[model samples]
Target chain A: MSKVLVADFGTGNLHSVMTAIQVVSSGSEVEASRSARKIRMADRLILPGQGAIGTWMSELQDDNVRQAVNEAVRTKPVLGICLGLQALYEHSEEDGGVEGLKVLAGRVERFSDGLNDCGHRIKIPHMGWSKVHQTCQHPLWSGIPQDTRFYFVHSYFARSDRDSEVAAVADYGLEFTCAAARENLFAVQFHPEKSRRQGLRLLTNFLNWNGEV
Target chain B: MPLAKRIIPCLDVDEGRVVKGVKFVNIRDAGDPVEVARMYDRQGADELAFLDITASSSNRETILHIVEAVANQVFIPLTVGGGVRTVDNIRSLLNVGADKISINTSAVERPEFIEEAAGRFGSQCIVVAVDARRVPDTNPPAWEVYTHGGRKPRGLDAVEWAKRMCDVGAGEILLTSMDRDGTKIGFDLELTRAVSSAVPVPVIASGGVGELSHLADGIEFGWADAVLAASIFHFGEYTIAQAKEHMKGRGIEVCEIIDEFE
Candidate 1:
């Protein structure tokens, strides 16, 4: 059984993440904790966050979760979701620019005002499910087909500096990076927990994955 | 493509079971809230809203338990409403895995409550539910906001209240037409259009959804970002897949339904 630690940054839906992980990955022990030692000891780590970047940053610092996450990601597979994915970037334009964890070389950007293919004005939050186009092959993508829809709810999206790190892309008004992957880290701007069957498949893959590229 | 229009199935819960009725009368038991919610999730519902119609304090614990149970198995966006009078109530629901909280009566009583809740939690998590009814005697036949489950009408105009709620920080407006509710004729397109145009946030055109085409009309004509229904879905008149297929055929963008699990 895998020991998975869902790092609680005090912002997002920590319980839901833990619930999804436990429900999808049976036999694996999943716990949501703010403890640095527990996070370091886990086989896999999940950094789940939501809400504003400014408050998230402060909470991470106050709880010292930023350092714990940075340490855990180096030696183990780490996955970030929603604001957690954005937090892995260098900085974000949210709340007048807040510094992120800088685990990945990217910046979070807001969608510009534009009309979609339907000529309708795009909503800001980009709320609802959308298809994720796989840009490259990885263990996490196993058993999941290309262009599978995942649930997304955010105003800002991550733009990785290195195109090689982008694992998948999705279109709103324009195409943007939705999932990023590095040596031992994989982060998605969408919520896999809320993506139904495909989401559960991805979580199951994560549970079975080792810390590898 | 733009974000797909959402089709949400609302479950009016009382003391932990799912119930449905016409205009809050002639209520009938549907089933266990969690089981019904799981069925809808499997049927590919875009979202789910659970309103505790029995807002009495005695049933509050049961509602929270139901929310937790549904949230565990549903794996989709869940919005919980009824008796959300304070930030603490919103927090409790969110803690139990509710993605959003809808406020109706409290929002009308203290308009600033919308601003406060939206400010504390992000606006995306705050939904202002407006239950409105048409008043033909007015010069423009304005719709007035109703409280206590459409039993009491307030002086505030529906469109104006929707605009104010958006300005203050309501991420979405759940506009329900009391006149058209449960009648199965269709949504009040005029009222939906008025509010949709008045606010920049996404508007969920709710109530009076009987036929499948009404769902399409709510998007094509009413300019609603989403359409919500209870009776049709609860009674199994049409599956969510059928509704989405019909809407897609009508040129409305909807999330493709994937029924298989690998």
Candidate 2:
């Protein structure tokens, strides 16, 4: 029996995340919890947080999840979504420059103001569905085709100095890293839970990933 | 290509049931909220908005149940609005499964409510709804903001009001035009362009949409980030796929289905 724990550390809304997981989990055991022990015992870990990274990090520390998460990424398949993806980086420009979980070697920077795409001004938060281009091969990319449109809503995005870890690319004002892959860790800026069938397919891939690259 | 301009179908629920009309009157029954939601999801709608028009506070529980049921089955962003006044109200809806909270009446009553909710929940999920009607006999032409189901006018300029809402931390604006709502000639492009140009965040154009061309016009001319409609999509007059294809043909970027089963 596979155990999946969605990191519900009381920092962000995990209702949709939990529901989407159960739909794709079939008969697997899926629980959304903040309990540090349950988090460590789970076979797969999903760390999802939104809003500001400062509050997200503080709450993770308050709930004693920071250390547990760092340990989980080293051994199990870990998936991050939205701010959950941003928090895996080392630092961010949000909330006057906050620190992240440092699970990957990158930094999160806010999308510059007055960004124009094909002569039209692009809005901040980069809301709605856009195509996601696969940059490298990973188990998570298994059934889903390349450049599939996924739902995105954020003001900032992440970039890694280590190109090998970059798993996906998306263009708003310019192409940026939307998904990163490093061994057992895979994180995405888009919300797979809300991306409809393609999204549900990605989650199903995560449930059966086995932590392989 | 950048982010696809969204095609969001609005479901006005009264006591947990979905209803449609020409102008929020002569209500016609359209199946259960969950069933309608599922149908839209399967048809590849970019997003779904649930506006509770139920008159009394007693319907709050019913709305919550409807939201939870749809959220569980449909794997997409669910925006729930209608009578959202308190932070606790936002929390309760988000706790159930709402991705975004739209505020209309309460926001007009208290402008700071947008700031408070945005500060607590992040601007990404806070949407300010503006219902406006054109001010006749004006030099440059303008629209005035209305509240209480368009029964009262607040004397605020619609374009300026949208910018102010964004300034106060509103992530998106749902701009609805009362003058052209039931007539269905098309979206108020002049109003849409004015507000879309005034705000820094995304503006979702609502109210007037009769043909597929109106949906494309909202994106192409009105400069709306998303186009929302009712009756047309509810009555099965046009599918979201057909709408997206129409938009794509018009040189607008839209998300298309790529092996939904794959």
- Scored by lDDT, the top model is 2
TM-score of only chain B in every candidate structure: 0.94, 0.95
Q: What tens-digit string does per-residue lDDT give for candidate 1 at B83-174?
A: 88988888888899998899999999999999998777788788999999999887766899999999998999899999899889888899
iRMSD computed for candidate 2:
1.6
lDDT by residue (tens digit), candidate 2, A1-213: 899999875654688889889999987899988788888899999988777777777767754576788889889999998888898889999889988888889899988767465455578879999999998888888878888999999999998878998999999888899999888998999999888888888899999998977
Put down candidate 1 lDDT per residue, A1-213, tens digits, no spaces: 679898776775777788889897778888888887888788999988877778778777755556777887677898888887898899999889999888889899987766556555566677888889999999999988888888888889988899988999998877889999989899899999888878888888888888686
Which stretch of 10 consecutive residues in model 1 chain A shows the poorest summed lDDT?
A114-123
Q: Against the true structure, what is each candidate's TM-score?
A: 0.94, 0.96
The most accurate candidate by TM-score is 2
